[model samples]
Target: MDKDFWLTKWASNRIGFHSTDVNPLLIEYWPALSPKGDEHVLVPLCGKSEDLVWLASKHQKVIGVELSEIAVRAFFAEHFYLPLVTHIDSSHVYYEFDELEIYQGDVFTAPLSGVDLIYDRAALVSIAPSQRYAYAQRLCSLLKPGGRILLITVDYVQDELAGPPFSVDAEQVQQLFPGMKTMLLCRQEADQHHPKIARQNLTRFADEVWLIEA
Candidate 1:
């Protein structure tokens, strides 16, 4: 998968991955991270996710990096937020509204740093496994020392389906972020009744939440 793929996905509204509601796991586990409430939170590959709104409520600043300009504008429009837009560079457009800021560009190239907490609800899983190492490296560079990540990942049989939402189990998570202190926070069995899993005919699907300290 590449930038054009995601840009096409957003332009075509083929966004089954986009969630309308705040993730329950985030609500339950974010507080355990014990955020200072003045910290800068980063949400990567954030496609107008409602989780960004929730994070903005809890933090002094919430920065999201998304590739789709369509998604970025939709976010502020949906929330009735009139953001001040600026072209940061050829690769990036910056949008700011109140406590929320979104960089509409490629995650790897976006100018990002000093992130206190990273909320990785769907970012990691969306990357092709071959590129996850690069993704992890870029994220680590953006994060401050002692920064924390509240990451949610899904695990399933890779051969069972072609995926943008790929199977990234505990071991792969460790491999992706070698030497980072990772603690598994929770695991929930994926609902077989859910249309995504049901159609794929996956026998085992589970979501794991992890707290990573850098």
Candidate 2:
């Protein structure tokens, strides 16, 4: 998908993929990373996720990169804080509230060389299949050596569906992060009662979380 796809999604309020609360998976799995105070964590395709606010509340510095300006603006606005604006190359930097900073531009173009940890809940799977390899390589380059990456992906049989919420199984994740030690932390069928996925015709859907060390 191109930038316009996401921009339109945000503009039209077509963000069913956006979670209403901090993801339970993140709550249960993130502490395992043991992020230290002042260390920077990268959240790619962050949108207006409350998870960033949750992380920041714990004294961790958060750098979130998003493609949609609407999502970026909504994030700061909804939080009742204004950002310190700056331009960086092709992206616009919005830094505010001391804890969170967002880059409004393509994630591939955002500078991420110094990121301590990568926390991706919706980033990777949201990209189309043709872009997954490039996205993975960019992620690797952005992460520090020995740094950790926390990824959440979905597995389902409905490959025919046109999706921004794409399907990515464990094997694909392994191939994508070949240089890192990849371990599955959790895997369970997504709740059928979940309002978002309930309408899908698929028999079963699984959420798999992986911990990758660079």
Candidate 3:
């Protein structure tokens, strides 16, 4: 998958991954990071997520990078925020508001050198396997030394489903971020009652969360 894949997903409103509520898993695990309420946090591939609002409410500053201008605009609009927009570059635009800034462009092009925390709810699993190693590198590159990551991923038999929430098992997570101190925090079977899982026709699905320190 390339930029067009995601851009088209947004354009066509095909985002089954977009959660209208703050993910309960994030609420449960964020405090484990022991945030001091004054650290910059990066939310990658954020697609108008309510979690962005929740993070900013609890943290110092929240930065979100999204590929879709429509998603970014919708994020601000949905939050009732009137952002001061700037044209960062030809490929990117920036939106700034109280304690929140969104970079609208390809995530690889966003200038996230380092942040104190990263909340990777769907960012890693959304990418294809071929790009995962490089994606992990980029994630580490953007986090400070000793920075923390709260990552959530899905694990399932790939042949059973074609996915944006791709199957990223524990072993692959280790291979993806070899330099980090990683720990498995939780692993739960996907809810069969959930519409996405039902639609995917998956009988064996695992939803996992991990904590990583760089």
Candidate 4:
């Protein structure tokens, strides 16, 4: 998938991936990181997610990187946050209000570093497998030493469905992060009643969460 693919998805409101409420898994497992409430958190491919609001409550600063301007604007508007906007460069725009800041542009080129924690709910599974190594490398570059990543991914038979929520199994997750230590925290079968599964006739779907430390 190309950049315009996501831009179009946001513009046309075909955001089946967008969650209206905070993800339950995030709430259940976030505290496992023992956040001191002073770490800088990064959320990549963050599409106007309610998770940003929840992360901000737990961290000193929560930074989100997204490609779609519509999604960024909608995030602030939906949250009733009037952000100070700044043009970072030809490729990026930064929006900030209190502890929340979002960079609207290419996540790979966004000017960011020294993140203590990275949250990847939708990012990893959303990328094409060929580019996931580069994506993971960029994430490592953005993190501080001893930093951690809270990642959530989906697993299913790829031939059964075309995906943005692609199947990224534990073995691939380990390979993507190469030298980093990966710990699987949860593995649960996908709810058969979930709209995507039911509509797509997905016979086997599972969700997994991991903690990766650098």
The sequence of per-residue lDDT tens digits that candidate 2 reaches over residues 18-54 is 8879999998998777777777889999999999998
- What are the per-residue Cα lDDT tens digits for candidate 1 across 1-214? 3788899998999998888999999999998678989999999999999999999888989999999999999999999999999999898999999899999999988888788999999999999888998999888888898899999999889998788789899998888788899999999886879665788788888889999989
* Model 2 poorest 10 in a row by lDDT: 88-97
Considering only N, C-alpha and C atoms within 3 Å, which residue pairs clash in candidate 2? Answer: none
| Clashes (N, CA, C under 3 Å) per candidate | 0, 0, 0, 0
TM-score, cand. 4: 0.96
lDDT of 4 by residue, 66-138 (tens): 9999999999998899999999899999999999999999988999978999999999898887888899999
Question: Each prediction's Cα lDDT score?
Answer: 0.91, 0.84, 0.89, 0.91
Stronger candidate by lDDT (1 vs 3): 1
The candidate that achieves the highest lDDT relative to the unseen native structure: 4
In model 1, the runs with Cα more than 4 Å from the true position are none
TM-score winner between 1 and 3, please give it: 1
Q: Which stretches in model 4 have alpha-carbon errors above 4 Å? A: none
